[model samples]
Target: MQYFPVFLNAQNLDCLVVGAGEVAARKVELLAKTPATIRVVAPQACQTIQAMAEQGLLKWIQREFDPGDIQGQQLIFVATDNHQLNCDISTLAKAANIPVNVVDNTELCSFITPSIVDRDPLLVALSSSGTAPVLLRYLRQKLESILPARLSELAKFSDKFRDKVKAHFNNVNQRRHFWEDVIEGDIAETVLAGDNQQAEQLIEQKLQQDEQTEAGCVYLVGAGPGDPDLLTFKALRLMQKADLVVYDRLVSKPILELVRRDAEKIYVGKKASLHSVPQNEINQLLVDAAKQGKRVVRLKGGDPYIFGRGGEEAETLVEQGISFQVVPGITAATGASTYAGIPLTHRDHAQSVVFSTGHLKDGSIDLDWPALARQRQTMVFYMGLTGLNVISQQLIKHGVAADMPVAVVQSATTDKQQVVTGTLMDIQQKASEANIQPPALIIVGTVVSLREKIG
Candidate 1:
């Protein structure tokens, strides 16, 4: 480490800036974000600095560098075109045992400001210690996206109850465990989700309890077709905290790899005519794991409610009275269709869209053929590859054209994705010729014809 990182207390801090041009203005703006008393001395001030001073943001001593400026200042920033003047200010501040930062000059400085991400009471400071500034900024942008905006509120909420919680627990270890449960449990989640009232109630209820229950919650997260990038922030967060992950076959390998490193995983995905793990067994697994105080993630491919039997699992959770949260993911049809350059509904080609499962239940794909055969409407079928011949014959028999444009998209949104476009009469043959795999989507409509144009 080139420099040790410290979050200096800004309350009642005395800050001094020896220059007032653009570079100095940037430093002033950062200091202004805190409750610091600022004094800037410069011969000529930029418009930004002048505006800040006019608005009572800081005290501007409109004069050249003065040794008096360093007096009583706890922190000093030297940002001047004159190298000698910056060096002189740095020497004065360092000799007085005050921290000084000479912008762009590391050797003359006592400390350097880092790229800061401010979330009120919660702040993230990242630095390369004046080296690799651009890389530091890039890292800052990444952190901004991953960090929640309301994290400050969550931190404040915890702070408000710290003393009360400490008093409630006689042992320090017990208090530490309580805080762990609060921050990692639903209380912190509800707070971050913007339900502070509910969080407060939960916290109060927890305090009144004689003992904390070992019952853990379940998260039904959609893996979003096959793309790892398509996972939601909530989904990612829950996945990382998972003590156990129950995933499906359709969930891509890349997406599956994102689950918590130490989390236990079980594959309950079904193959055609084969049940790897029965649906009822899978439901029971979730309830049992959660009852054992395991943070369980029931990871599903695509939208779970959409043919993924997510409703079945949710009903089971409800029946068992297990606390759970559902994080939605992009369904296969929409994701696959778009990546194949086949819009589900277009102004001229498709007026409406219908989603159906071609997987036969009891021996036949029992869909309303007449409604599905409507013109100018796009038809998407999940698990349709096996019943492609039946689907084609049924649609054609139900007044649909045999030459209706069709597309079969396999592994949608992934590097291995493949799209086979042909007429309904010939798509099955084309798909077979290319050896298109399962976990594919069938998009049927004139929109499939636009693949050549838009794709």
Candidate 2:
């Protein structure tokens, strides 16, 4: 570690800032977030700094920064444009036994500010010891996407019950176990979901229960189409907390990487010609894992409820009495269509959207041809690549126009995404020529034509 990381309490502490430019203004803004008594001394002040001074947020001494300004201050910030003056300020602060930060000059900095993800009570800071500020900021942005905005709410809520929990579970290990379960289980989920009353009630109930025993639960999380960015904050949180992850083929590799590293990952992915693990076996595996007092995650791609067999898994969990929560994701139909620039519904084209699975249990392309053949409606078929020829022939034979536009989007929303477009009369041939693969979406409607205009 280049620098020992520490968080200082800024409340009611006198802090001195030497400058009034953009950098100093930004420093003041950060300090203002705390209850620090800030004093800025410079030859001139920016409009924002002057406004803050007039509003009594800070004291602005309109004069050149001198060694006297560093007196009686707990911390110092040197943000002046002049390099020599900044160095002089840093020297004075160090001489006075005060910690000082020289902006943009890491060599002179007694302390450096980190890129902070401020979820209030749950703050995450990233620092490169001033060697790579941009990299720190990039990492902060990644964390911002994964961490829930309302995570602080859970922290605040738990604070109210800390004493009660501490009193109830006197044993250190028991208390630690209890808190772990509470934070990784439904209590935290309820609080994160904005149900404070339910969360508090659940917390009380747990506290009243035997702290020696811990119950296990499962989360049915949608990993989204292909992009890990599409995964919900709740999904990411549960993924990291899971003790075991049961995933499928549709779940992207990038999405699976987000799961906790220590967690056991079992692949039950099913391909068109392969079933590595049967559906019943996968369901039983989740139940068995939870029975072992483990937090299990049955992660699926796309919206779990949307033909992802999540309903079946959820039903099995219910019968087995395993507690679980479902986190939705961006399904292929919406994700593929948008990325391919084909609107699923439009006033000038499609009025209604229909989603169907092209693959059937008994290996047959059985669908309501007449209903799907209707105009002014968009149809999206999942797992339909293998049955594209049948789908095209059936639709065209069932009173649908032979020239109806169709599009096949493969690996939708991913870098490998490929789109093949043609009329119903020749879509199968076009898809074959493009060599479109599985995990693709098939769109059949006039909306397919819009891809040319808007794509």
Candidate 3:
């Protein structure tokens, strides 16, 4: 590591900033986040900074920076265009044992500003040691998406119970374990959902309960179509805190990589005519893991309720009286169709959309051909690649035009995504020629024609 990361307490410190241009304004904006007294020395100041100075937010001295300007400040920021002046300020600050940051000059900086995701008490900082600032910023952007905006509110709410919790559980480990449960359980969920009063009550209720015994629960999380980015915030939180993750084959590798590193992963994925682990056994596995007082995550691809058989697993959990939470994900139909540039319902084309499964338990494709053949409605078939011929034949046999536009999106939303478009008369042949695999979605309707315009 080129630099050790540490957060400074600016509440009682004096900060000196020497500049008035855009760079200096940026630094001042960051400093405003803290409680430090700011003093800016520049020949001229930007309108924003001047307004701030007028508002008594900072003390601005309209003059060139002098060496004496560094005398009493605890932290100094040199953002002036003059390199010599910046270096002089840096040397003076260093001599006085003050920390200094020179904007855009890594070598002259005693400390570099890290890209921050500020959730008040819950702040996450990313830095590349000045070697890859853009990379650090990119990571910050990714984290910003995954983290809930109410995270800071949750943290603040939790802070109120620290003392009471500590008093209830005298042992440090006991208190820590209790907090982990509260954070990963319904209490955190309620707070993140913007119900602070309920969260507080839930926390108090948990505090009154016996902390000696820990109950294990399961979270049925949808990993979304192939892209890890599509995973929901609640899903990501549960995945990271899980003690064991029971995942399916349809779950993408990138999404699986986000699971807690120390958590055990059990593959219960099923392929066509091949079951690595039967559905019953997978349900039993979840029950067994949860019974052991482990936080278990049943991670599946796409929406768990949508043909993912999540209802079955949930039923088993209910039968066994095991507590579980279901977190919905972007179903493949919506994700794949959108990424393939085939809108399921367009105002001018498809007024309604229907989702259907092409694969069945008895290895037969039994669908409502009459309803599916209705006009002005788009049909999205999940796990339908294998039953494409049957679907195509059935749709055409039931008054649907064989020339209706159809598009098959394979590995949707991923880098390897492929879209194969053809008419109902030739879609199966086109899919076969393209070697489109399972986990692909089939869209049928006039909206399929819109792919050419938008794709």
Q: Count the backbone clashes (under 3 Å) in each candidate.
A: 0, 0, 0
Q: For candidate 2, list the clashing residue pairs, or say none.
A: none
Candidate 3 C-alpha error for residue 384, in Å: 1.0
Clashing pairs in 1: none
lDDT, candidate 3, 1-455, per-residue tens:
77898988888989999998888999899889889999999989999899999999999999987888888789999998899988888888888899999999988988998899999988898888888877888899999999999999889988988888888976553565688878878999999999999988888787777657567899999989989999999999889888889999889999999998877898888987789998899999999988877889999999999999999999999999999999999999989988888878988988899999888888789988899999999998888888898899999999889899999998999988999999989998888899888778898999989888996
Top candidate on lDDT is: 1
Q: Name the lDDT value of residue 100 in candidate 1.
A: 95
What is the C-alpha lDDT profile of model 2 across 223-305, one tens digit per residue?
Answer: 88999998999999889878889999988888988998878899999987679998999999999988877788889999999
RMSD of each: 9.6, 9.0, 8.4
lDDT scores in order: 0.90, 0.89, 0.89
1 against 2, candidate with superior lDDT: 1
TM-score of each: 0.60, 0.62, 0.62
Can you tell me which runs of candidate 3 are displaced by over 4 Å? 1-132, 135-177, 181-209
Which regions of candidate 2 deviate over 4 angstroms? Answer: 1-177, 181-209
Model 2 accuracy (lDDT, Cα): 0.89
